[model samples]
Target: MKSKMLTVLFMFFTMYSGFSQDFQGKATYESKTQVNMDFGNRQIPEDRKKEIMERMKKANEKTYELVFNAKESLYEEDEKLEQPGGNSGRGRGFRAMGSAGGDLYKNIEDGRYLIKNELFGKIFLIEDDLEKLDWKLESDTKQIGKYTAYKAVAVKTVKRPNMQALFRRRNTDGKDGEGTKEKKVEEFIEKEVEIVAWYTPEIPINQGPADYWGLPGLILAVSDDVTTIVCSKITLNPKEKIEIKAPKKGKKVTQAEYDEISREKMKEMRENFRGGRGGGRGGARF
Candidate 1:
């Protein structure tokens, strides 16, 4: 009886991995993100937490129109997660537009996004150089709809990707392999991410948000800083053959450029909003 059961289990897992690519589902994530500046591991003051909070709070809600299928269906959506209130008069994230779309796998791989508003739209992309999947197979599992999946931890790095190699010896579109010319940034470019997914061999596709894909099932939960965007609520096949793709608007830059540009924009906005002045009797502190 024991031998028979083992064979059945092996057959089931093989089936599950094969079917992972074709699944489409929805999920929600509960995240606590804290941002810190790094100039060689220097510690920032605790009091400054409010300032960071204020910057995020001030950021305007952003949305995007994700178009899947060679220009299939499109929807307008605010892309970034936000706090419920507006920014102070100084204005931070003055033009934040957070949204996205595409097929389960193809969308994210296209690697493009619109930041701020349509007028000030910018691009956001990620270049992952991870070998194999980061998640591990676990004996502990859970049921997401009909699929059962295990958890895994992906420990890897996110760097300012060198676009020179992409150009393949073409000078017109090639960048120097050295990365950004600016002083080397001290941010923790690489991150250790943990993902919990429930996929079955019923599907066959390798697609997940950047840096994560290739598992037995659809990735229901993923966290890797910018990629942490998770499924807050899931309604599987809310509509059939839901497609995922990249946003088309604004400028296009490599993953490395996007990383620095985003944080710098945030930094500049926060800096301008700093030590809020021109206040009443009780003024805002820096």
Candidate 2:
């Protein structure tokens, strides 16, 4: 059955090659992340805890759109108006858990990517080579909408922000000096995680929602350890052609440089929290 599917996909791609120039697709994706908030030994009212969870959930749920053709694709969030007394204010710290700021443009033909990311108040244009994932195709199949999707898995090593360190309270045991506090920098640690993607050959573009690509078909759904991004809607060959262009604004930097800058900024924030400059009582806010 796998061989049959591949054969049919090859034939379909060959037939669609002539119309590739005019074939463009717009896919809307709904992205959500599961967050486990631990307040350590601090005792909190149940009502306040529930409120915090609600705010975090609202902050983590997001909508994105991907515009793609044969060679290049652009993915960015679809902004929405915040509700009254929403999580917009306290959601800054949780920004690292979701998709990065600005537009992500991938050129599959050239194996390059350009991402526009904003950190604190600085805008950075991250230009780097596209990360090629070693995907292992599986024989499992499932139905996503009106398409028959196949399963593919890939293991990726990513730098995840240490949430425990961010909320850890300073030790004020007064071991060395009177009224002294132990300061620890919040850092990102590297870990290996498995990525599962569902693709359908009906849309033969090697594009996915975020930085995921190089699949045999268009990826409809993808999930990692804490987040899941799924395509909710797809529009093919719309009346108006969307211009797929790379963002030119912001200071140019590589991915590594951007990460280093983020680490330094996080450290600064941690220090500020320790110095009683952050939220009330519990060192850092959610």
Candidate 3:
């Protein structure tokens, strides 16, 4: 009975120990990404191309955050946002129909410290190419931030959930905005993506923009294929408390489970919408 009672008390203490302390800081980096698709040898109208490019503009300029602490570290790369030049988007994430976004996550709190800041690390994403891969790492190096930081490299392996290589289809009736029917076919789809990041323990704040964490420090900068996030500056332990957040709460799945869910959701979206504007405004990244 004493042993059981001790175990229960230990569990209680552990749960209560997770009260995150107050912190304030900024994370920033540059991102670069490529969006490709097949037009099926069909010629896309100029207007359609213009519209797609507009969407791409938003995708390339999205932002994402990485968060970490003593418990877990997750990376949600390339999250898109509703507005441009904002701090809400995930890491260099891309999307198609609705609002393009980015998100990446991982849980490594229960594991060993392994390599603090190596030259390269492998990361994995959900896509036809990455679906088979159990894991993929990337290159990194130690640096400085609010504290000691490690530099992460770019892989370009992951892609945005809603993102796809699209080719425009000409409308049958080209009466210049006269209700001309248009078609958009997927040209390319890839899941693997690479990003460079900088993490530090300066303020000992383990919060990033999106699902990024795991370093002995916090993420100060991140970037995707074409987009980059640079934490120009930050202030530690302000008057309020700041907690890291997942792309979307209510996620009751492991890494593999989340990948499966995201994949199925994207697949369903593509099938249901076909050549129309499908999916919601949420942004899911590669």
Candidate 4:
């Protein structure tokens, strides 16, 4: 009887492992952000403004993919490389300005996450425990592709760039204003954004793009007024298994530390842009 029980337990364990592996898959998402073209003090010709608008449109529309299994997921932006001698559709009047999309990995079962961020040409690897979101699930349901998705809402405090404060006011306290000083000011405004997410329990995985997770299902669509991300395609149980790994390259830092570093860098960039300016006030102390 003991030998028989052992054999039965071994078979059950194998079946469960196979089931988990079979449910692994990949999802592709299309993201778009609605942004106002606010060029402060930077004047451009009307025709040039049109070109910049077109470029901004392409830049705001992005493609991302999430590869996941039963426990963990890796998310990153998918970029289309411009081949040599290929027309990029980008105008030559202005340089195409863009930052590297950060990579995020989350372990659902263990409540762990790793974020690899590149800000102002500096790399930072943020590794910390997952932040539990207080999501309010609703009874509303809709069809996303073939899956039935349910609605959920979360309030998140996010740091947004203040375009008006891009240029700092200079100090005029100088001997006949012969020399000037540049004042570093805070450029980020902290505010709450309502996040709406649609998830499907049929997938049986608690995963989503970016830093969103902990739903009873896999998130299919997420929007927060300004930005929206929707799943475009999904491939389940492909022939080759997806490899999920944490990002290891970059200066090691916590999430809070990284935020401080980012703010400091932005201040430096603002000061550098204005050349030589006078002292100003009204920036955050920390």
The prediction achieving the highest lDDT against the true structure is 2
**Model 2 segments more than 4 A misplaced:** 1-5, 8-12, 15-18, 41-46, 87-99, 173-186, 279-286
The clash number for model 4 is 4
TM-score of each: 0.47, 0.87, 0.47, 0.77
Q: What is the C-alpha lDDT of each candidate?
A: 0.38, 0.76, 0.41, 0.69
Question: How many backbone clashes does every candidate have?
Answer: 41, 0, 93, 4
Off by over 4 Å in 4: 1-22, 83-100, 167-185, 276-286
What's the candidate order when arranged by decreasing lDDT? 2, 4, 3, 1
Q: Candidate 3: TM-score? A: 0.47
lDDT of 4 at 47: 95
Question: Model 2 over residues 184-256: C-alpha lDDT tens digits?
Answer: 4346768899999999877888889888997878999999998899988999999998889998888998888
Root-mean-square deviation of every model: 12.1, 4.1, 13.2, 9.6
lDDT of 4 by residue, 59-145 (tens): 778888999988889888885786687443322111111112578888888888887776644666887888788988776778999
Off by over 4 Å in 1: 1-134, 158-204, 209-211, 224-245, 263-286
What is the Cα-based lDDT of residue 88 in candidate 2?
45
Candidate 1 positional error at 57, Å: 9.2
Per residue, candidate 3 scores C-alpha lDDT tens digits across 157-273 of 553443432223234353212354534433334565565666553444334444344333456766665455666445544455446543342323344444454455455555433
lDDT of 1 by residue, 1-286 (tens): 4554344357557754543444454343333323332212213466674675556443322222222232122233434544368422212222211222211123333442322122113333332232465555555556655554445455554442121111112112232233323233222243444445544433323334323455544454555444343433444444667755434443544434545564454444333323232122232222
- Which candidate would rank higher by TM-score, 2 or 4? 2
